[model samples]
Target: MKIWGEIMGKADDVMDICLLAGQIMLTYGAETYRVEETLERMAKSASFSNIHCFATTTGIFLSFEEKKEKEDLMQMVRVDDRLQDLGKVTDVNQVSRQFVAGDITIEEAHEKLTAIAKAPMQYPLWLIHIAAGIAGGGFSYLFGGGWFDLIPAFIAAVVSSIVVVEFERHLKVRFAAEFTAAFAGGTTAILLVLIGIGSNLDQIIIGSLMPLVPGVPLTNAVRDLMSGDLLAGVSRGAEALLTSLSIASGIALTISVFL
Candidate 1:
């Protein structure tokens, strides 16, 4: 009885992990035809061989092609326990698209991805604070203000953004460290302009926080979709836009308050 229950539990876990792999594949912009392949590869990496029970790479594609039947294709046992160890994939649009494309069910894939994403990672507080401050100082310096003023402004921006990041972390209680760290990049940019240290506004703003700008992700995201890598494109683009806007908002608010 104990062994039977254990197997059933393991089976459920495998299914969850397998679906998560599909979600990540989609988020990373893998093609519908390729998502299953990615999922299989990731599963194997986690040391589970039971995932073969799920459909084959070819079979998954065929199922998607056969969407009219509404048949569930998640029943291959060849994957065995291989499906029990998938991690999160941070590409939302790709995941959505692939699920809609019938490569995987939205509910299963999305749920597993969300679950895995909640796992923790290192959160760098001081570095993020310094980055934001540096962003501010760089912006002010570019504008032609004296180093004295620029230094203060830089310090202010860094300090304020750090507080904001910390407060946000406290309230949200998610990846506080990471959230603040990434957010600090934008805040630093905002702080520079508010302090009014530089000459060419455009150049100063642009130069100050270029490091924080998610340019590659934004450009690639759009380009990927336009170039037919829809899954990957959407994922990166959304992330870029959000990050850009965040930086702008952070700085704008500080400047407005100072002015």
Candidate 2:
């Protein structure tokens, strides 16, 4: 009985490690296949057999058996509040590879994963906002806006990004935040154009709205579809569609009111 208890305790730890790794990957925009592969690899490295992993956009299911006793353990992890953070995905992948290569023990892997889970964003929020502004200005130029439009586009993009971030932080509603950001961006562009600060309202609004586009989610959805993860693909695609609609609706509302 004591031996079985010890085995179960070890199995529980391994299960926790796998689940945490999978959760981090899913939350940070990893493909479902990648998450499953990583989970299986980690379990195998820990000497667990009969590994079964199934991952979707919203959850992960994992099971494995101990090689000695053939006892099985299964666990499911529910993932919510997903966002695009390829940096975290890369970090988790590196750790998984290291563990599989026998460079780290399961306890060490768990420690590292815990630290990563608690780590803050790779870039500061202010820097992200600044980058959004720069992207907005560059996109405006690319979209045929004149040199004079750059400042307006930059300002609008910065404001929109701030609004979205702040709104989401407080409300925890993604669609509403995105819609508000788009509307704010469009309105800012129009006002800037009216005040002669921008040459082209359309270009400024287009550029500023680029910051809120679901580019990563949409790309990931297509990639998931190509990878044969139909469930994850369809769900992510739907999410992208809704986000796009929210942004479009906000912009349309702004246009109706101002233009």
Candidate 3:
């Protein structure tokens, strides 16, 4: 009787661990398709047969097998965090997963990540001006415009980068989009606003904004790649590059009437 009870108890603990791990991974940003895979691996390691995982944008649930056959498989869940750290770590998503894996508490991650996230992130206006001038002037020179047009090109780089920053601030403070959409939309909106102001966006594209926008993602991807998050780093880099192109394209479309 004693032996049977001990076996049942160990089984229960395994189930508990699997269910908790699943819930935590979902919250950690695990995709729905991968949730079941994770749960299966966890359950097998935990030594169970009844393995399943369910999830939505809003929730995650899991079931595990044990010695208690036909018993109701348990489920565990938790609420979202009101506060979270969004810092630039060498491996961005790994921190989130580590936080979920019981390796480190959320509070600890938040503290460390907060510090990194708030770190100084800006390029001085003078450099921006020079970069923009070079880019715009070079493009103009390539396309048969006079050297004087480089002035507007320089101004364009400065303006575009500034607009991205300003737009990013509005999204963070007002609308609350995170790094991805905020970065993309912010750059886009800034260009739009410039066009609305009658500034030549074509010159801006030739300007230094490309360097400004690419810096963050490039940094983030480097961080991820260094952290051994190859997939994530590549994805972020691709996203950054694509977003930069999108902004340039948007500007081109808006001003194409002159061509």
Best by TM-score: 2
Error of 3 at 80 (Å): 3.7
- In terms of lDDT, model 1 sits at 0.47
Residue-by-residue lDDT tens digits, candidate 2, 1-259: 9999998998898899889999999999888988999999988988889999999999999999999998999999999788778898898999999989999887998999999999999999999999999999999999999999899999999989999999999989999999999999999999988988988888999889988989888888999899999999999999999999999999999999998
Candidate 3 residue lDDT tens string, 1-259: 7976766776665555444444444443443344455556655654566667654423556776564554446665652421111223233345445544657643455554454444443446566546644664466446554555555555555555455546555654212222333243234434544565324444434443443445545665676667565665676578567765655555554445333
The residue pairs in collision within model 2 are: none
Would you estimate the TM-scores of all the predictions? 0.43, 0.97, 0.37
For model 3, the run of ten residues with the poorest summed lDDT: 81-90
Q: Whole-model Cα lDDT per candidate?
A: 0.47, 0.92, 0.49
Off by over 4 Å in 3: 1-12, 78-259
lDDT of 3 at 12: 64
What is the number of backbone collisions in each predicted candidate, taken in the order shown?
Answer: 19, 0, 4
After superposing candidate 1 on the true structure, give the runs of residues whose Cα lies further than 4 Å from its correct spot. Answer: 1-11, 19-37, 43-120, 135-150, 170-212, 215-227, 235-239, 249-259
Flag regions of model 2 displaced more than 4 Å. Answer: none
